[model samples]
Target: MRRVRYYQYGGPEVLTVEDVDPPAPQAGQVLLRVEAVGVNFVDTRFRRGPGSGSIFERPLPGRPTGDVVGTITRVGPGGDARLIGRRVAALAEDAYADYAVAEAQWLAPVPENLGAGDASMLAMSAPVALRVLRSAPLRPGDTVLIHAAAGGVGHLAVQLAKLLGAGTVIGTARSARRLDFVRSVGADVAIDYSEPDWPDRVRAAAPGGVDVVLDAVGGPVLQASLDLLAPFGRAVVYGAATGKLEHVPVVSLFALRSVTGFNLTAWRRANPDEARREMDELTDLFAAGRLRATVHAGLPLTEAATAHQLIESRSHTGRVLLLPGGLGPGAA
Candidate 1:
């Protein structure tokens, strides 16, 4: 088996690919032949250090923490052998390998309409967007704003908001190149956040004010989103992409507005049933052609460092997939 592991954490250069012997699956776990792996900012944060307060106090000895989409090849005791030959997307023990073990319950059946690349990308963001939309209580005719509207979760959140009946969707991009792409994903209004008064543009485009706000950037942008919300609007903060946390003003809620933060990790732990339910809904949407998976780039597994560099650049438009078997974009 081959895998990418960071002997020590610092930068992309810390990640190195190496060949190793495959390990046996544990109870309730399935060993999957890797197809595609999702490269996420959370993975980067974890790769950086313990400053982000990840669950793993110490790096898993030698393994990297990630997830993948693969076919079931073997099962352990109490696992479903019938799952063999199943095409599944899983959150694995260490997905950066050719064969990784995943708890049976953490795997989702892949839809025929979606391919391995898209399925792998959705392993994280799709469920996240669904959960955030549910938390926003998205309703018909409600105007909404999404920060970092071109990033993974933001892109999915935009489409999910539109599908859930948001009357108008506004998106913000720090660069001009991303503006059109943001609008193409169902954003009625796209603003240039690179400018100081971008929020003013959001207000101009949405008129009265936005009814719901999904923020991935958490610096001045989060505060600006709160200011753009209409009375009785809900603001949900999901990520701190800016790498800085901001203090919220409680008095702002007096205008019938509310502010809350959502961490998918906590949500998944608390409501596994509902989480699975939402993933099913997203799968159905994908099958119906109502939602599309945005894949910006795919790199060979041995080039894990390159994948990390691309993600850290913050220039890609979609999820980055890693090919564990040195497969290219054409891989199944």
Candidate 2:
């Protein structure tokens, strides 16, 4: 089996592909012949260096972990034998490999009609976007503002807001291309957040002030977002991908507003049923052709480093996938 590993924290160059023995599944786990890997912005953050959101207490060897769609080849003790040949999507650690292990209990059976890349998007990004929007408790006819609206979660959130009944959807991106893409995805308005007067522009579009803010870009953008909220409005910060220090500006108690965050793991643990419901909703939307994940590019498994580069560059319009090509039951 081949996998990507980095013993030290650094840039994309640290990721190396090597052939090694495939890992066996543990109790309640199933081994998958991984078909595709989702490259998340947070995974790049984990690779760059230590951060407050890191999964580890100290720097350690890193193996990219993200959404993986694959076929079940084997199962460990206590796992269901009948699922061995079923294709599924899962969030797995140590997953930038040809084969990865995922928990059988939570496996999402991928429909035969769903491609690996889309299944990978459904595995994580779509659900996270849904969860982020709900964090602020979006209401019908609410004026919503979405930051980084052309990125993976961002793009999905834009379309979802409309479906969820938001009256006016405002999206922001750094480049004109991205802003255009945001508008195409259902944003009623799109602004260039990179401009100095971006916030002012946002105010011009919605002078009454934004009703909900879904932000992933951190640093200055987070602070600015707080200032743009209407009285009683809410801002949900799910990630800070700026690669810079992130902090919030002070808000007066009399402001009648709030800032919240959505940590996927914690949320799932607290509201398992709701989490499942969100995924089901996304699945239905995709099936009905009302929602779809825009695939930016697909690279081979050995070129995992390049995939990470594409994500870190922030140039891609949608999800970047790594295809673990030609190592599976279907191989000739």
Candidate 3:
């Protein structure tokens, strides 16, 4: 087996691929012949330093990509034998490898019609997008704003919001090209946050301001999002891709508007059953062609460093994926 690891954290240069012995699954786990892996900002954060918070019990020299899609090759004791040879998507630690272990209970069967890359892309972002939308009070005909809407979670949030009956879907990106891409994914209005008056643009587009705002970019963007809300509108903060929101005053909540933070990792830890239900719903949506997984780039697993560079650039829209075992864009 081969895996990507880093001895010290700083930049993409630190990551190196090494050949190693394959891992054996422990009780209640299944060993997957990994087909695809999803690369996220969090993976870049982990590579840069330890500030991202720990997912493992103890800090290790290497970190894992969180989303994986593969076929079950081995099942440990207490794991379902029937799952062997089944294709599934799951959240796995140290998934930047040819094979990885995943808890059987967390695995979701991938619809046969879905490609491995799309399955891996959806494994993490779709659930988070669905959960974020559910956290807010959304009504039919309500206008919704999604910041960083061309990114992994935001792209899915755009489609899911429209499918759930949002009248107008507004998405913000950093460039005109990116905004155009966001519009193709269901955003009724696309604003380039790079523009100083992007918030003003959003207001003009929605008239009375949007009813719900999904913000992943913090700092000034979060503040701007809060200001663009209509009366009683909800702003759900999911990530701080730019930086942390600073000096948010109590006055920001005027007019019954509110700000709520959503951490998918924490939410999943607290509501396991609900998490499973959300995953099922996302899978159904994908199978029915209602949800499309946008894959920005796919590279061979050994090129993990290159993948990291693309993600950190923030220029690519949608999920970046790594294909293991010689798999490429069109592989089944």
TM-scores, in order shown? 0.92, 0.93, 0.93
RMSD of 2: 2.8
- Cα-based lDDT for every prediction: 0.79, 0.84, 0.84
> What is candidate 2's lDDT per residue for 114-221, written digit by digit as tens?
766568767678888888888899999999999999998899999999999999999998777888888888999999988999999999999989999998888889
Q: For residues 171-256, what per-residue lDDT tens digits would candidate 1 score against the true structure?
A: 88766767888988888889988798898898788779889988877888888888888999999988876666888988878889
TM-score for model 1? Answer: 0.92
Question: Scored by Cα lDDT, where does model 1 land?
Answer: 0.79
Off by over 4 Å in 3: 50-60, 245-247, 329-332
Global local distance difference test of model 3: 0.84
**lDDT at 230 for candidate 2?**
93
Superposition error at 153 for model 3 (Å) = 1.1
lDDT of 3 at 70: 89
Clashes of each: 0, 0, 0
